[model samples]
Target: MSVNNIHEWDKGEYNITTDIKKIDRTAVHSYLTRSTWAKGIDFETVSYSIDNSLNFGLFHREEQIGFARLITDHATFAYLCDVYVLEEYQGRKLSNFLMSCIHEHPVFSKVRRLMLFTLTAPWLYAKYGYEPVNQQNYAWTILRKDMYL
Candidate 1:
């Protein structure tokens, strides 16, 4: 599949899609502002980020219930972030399906390295072959925690 093609997957009534137009920016911004890591983040910043990244949206019918994004060069590296499923939708294994779509997307087909920093749900990621960056030199980050506040 072409990297420019919109990718989609279905599970019962839910679906995951890589169509940027399907992402609900207001819902994403609302969830992120309440999240510990991105608390107080502004809409413009969120909008810009969404515009540039490869975003995945999980939906129940037409309502957006979850989201994730990859910042990538679409070949050598990708950083996964902003992954979440709404609290009301938590028990359905949608996250698993969402991750599956990300891995199967064309943008990630030639990725030599995929990275993510998660303060929660490491088990969820582990199920998909994501491992802790065990050695110190594997990553160096300049985190601006709560920067928007």
Candidate 2:
């Protein structure tokens, strides 16, 4: 499924958009490079990843403030990663709205599974129906802490 069109969602004074052109690579790189999982990642690498993923950018006016991206084929599965709302934007329920837009996305409507790996904010994700992968189930990873650094 080709998701080439922009999808927009609004709430109060903010908006979340799937318009790749609206993503501020500088802001995304700046935030993720300091984040726990993507620490040490560079701008070029971040840009490359964004180019390949289905991205959702949370914006206030014209500024890019929060973001999440999904690596998926628009069918069977999706890996939700690079999810965050800048500290100043936290506590406004923006993350919740972001998650709602993601889960309700037409591209993900038939997706069989969605996965995310987070070391913090489990409570936030839990509210969107995300839970721990049962250890006994088919889950595995070769998680490199700083693969691109």
Which residue segments of model 2 deviate by more than 4 Å? 1-4
Pairing residues by index, what is the TM-score of model 1?
A: 0.94
**In candidate 1, which residue pairs get closer than 3 Å at backbone N, Cα or C atoms, i.e. clash?**
none
- Each model's lDDT: 0.91, 0.91
lDDT of 1: 0.91
Model 2, span 1-149: residue lDDT tens: 12457789989889899989889999999999899888889898999999999999999999999999999998899999999999998999899999999988887788899999898899999998899988785898887865857
Per-residue C-alpha lDDT of model 1 across residues 1-22, encoded as one tens digit per residue: 2345888888999988888988
* Model 1 misplaced regions, further than 4 Å: 1-4
Each prediction's TM-score against the native? Answer: 0.94, 0.93
TM-score, predicted candidate 2 vs. hidden true structure? 0.93
Clashes of each: 0, 0
Q: For model 1, what is the alpha-carbon lDDT of residue 60?
A: 97
